[model samples]
Target: MSVTDKDRDILTRTLWGEARGEGLAGQIAVGWTIRNRVDDGKANSWWGESYAGVCQRPYQFSCWNKSDPNYAYLSGAKPIPPREFAQAQIAADQVMAGMVQDPTRGATHYYATSMPKPPVWVKGAKETLRLGHHIFFSDVP
Candidate 1:
């Protein structure tokens, strides 16, 4: 489907409770915002491996996690600390918050790029929440 159609579908799903309030569209918007920030090739704009590459596409940066070892490896550094991860989360949250009407139900996750393990809180909310590898958010109020 076209990008416009995909966005419409995502919005519909969110409104109808078929998807979370911070669903695919929110992710896409966040990613797009990050891409714009890093597209200038500024050294400090590097967030992770997924975002290290040029953002020719819009949603490429949304799934990136600076906390991941892979990102660190790519950037020639050790894994990011909790503070850095929190900063990244805040940045992502800021981007997503502007695109989405609701912020209470919006959440983002940062994962270890090289590790195979999932996020720590996945099991707890799996039954009631729509979970993804790097992020979790709810549609219910």
Candidate 2:
């Protein structure tokens, strides 16, 4: 699950409101975010550098490679396929969903889609979960 500079650049560039509004951008953002968080130490919280620091759970799990003593707990095996990546995305989405508010405050909610309109409030946080499954899990190219 080693992340590269390209991955970070892609996530940072694509995870913005404009890119997120577009479904494809949103999907890639989510995927790239998950991968970067795991490989690097980036946090995906709404506040980039607020009290909420970057999440490190993914990094902890990614520490284990096939040769590492704790590899089993880190991940099942090498080269986690797209399906597995999607599963991780879903799990991350579930966690993120819990953090979102229905009538979100200005600072509490963050948009991930790149739709043409202004920042559209997420109708339902579950949309992220569905997106995770569809983009990361499905075999769509």
Candidate 3:
């Protein structure tokens, strides 16, 4: 799949919002999860038809949710630290260019392990990877 400048920008912001504290490897894992979502044949239409679509899709990536703590930064109402934004951009470029293999191993879903309760959807899904604070899953039915 080819990534447009818009797609790269959206993905970079998403990495900044979702995985900024998790460092480069964490950002890459998050990027692959988004790519996996874009590639999932069975995802609901609201899940998105493109990178921007998915990342901005309501109620999907919580960082875009109005109530989410990261919304202000993600929505451009606040600035992301220059260093963090630069790191996220690097992660986005690598993934969009396929310069590094997917570290999530086809995972389309993930949640921070720090969440007190795992989402109900994880029940029957296969756990595919754990990097930083996130746990990734696939083969959901």
Cα-based TM-score, every candidate: 0.23, 0.22, 0.93
lDDT, candidate 1, residue 73?
Answer: 27
Model 2 agreement with the true structure over 98-121: per-residue lDDT tens digits: 332222111122332233542333
Q: Per lDDT, what order, best first? A: 3, 1, 2
Candidate 2: lDDT of 13? 28
> Which lDDT tens digits does candidate 1 get at residues 39-99?
4345654432223232222333322245433444223365434443444444444443454
Residue pairs clashing in model 2 are: 18-114, 20-112, 20-113, 20-114, 21-113, 21-114, 21-115, 22-114, 22-115, 43-54
The count of residue-pair clashes in candidate 2 stands at 10
Cα lDDT over the full model 1: 0.35
Better of 2 and 3 by TM-score: 3
Cα lDDT, model 3, residue 19: 95
Candidate 3's residue-wise lDDT over 59-91, tens digit each?
A: 778888899989898888999999999999999
Least lDDT summed over 10 consecutive residues: which range in candidate 2?
A: 132-141
What local lDDT does model 3 show for residue 123? 93
The candidate scoring highest on TM-score is 3
- Where does model 3 exceed 4 Å of error? 41-46
Model 3, backbone clash pairs (residues 3+ apart or across chains), number: 0
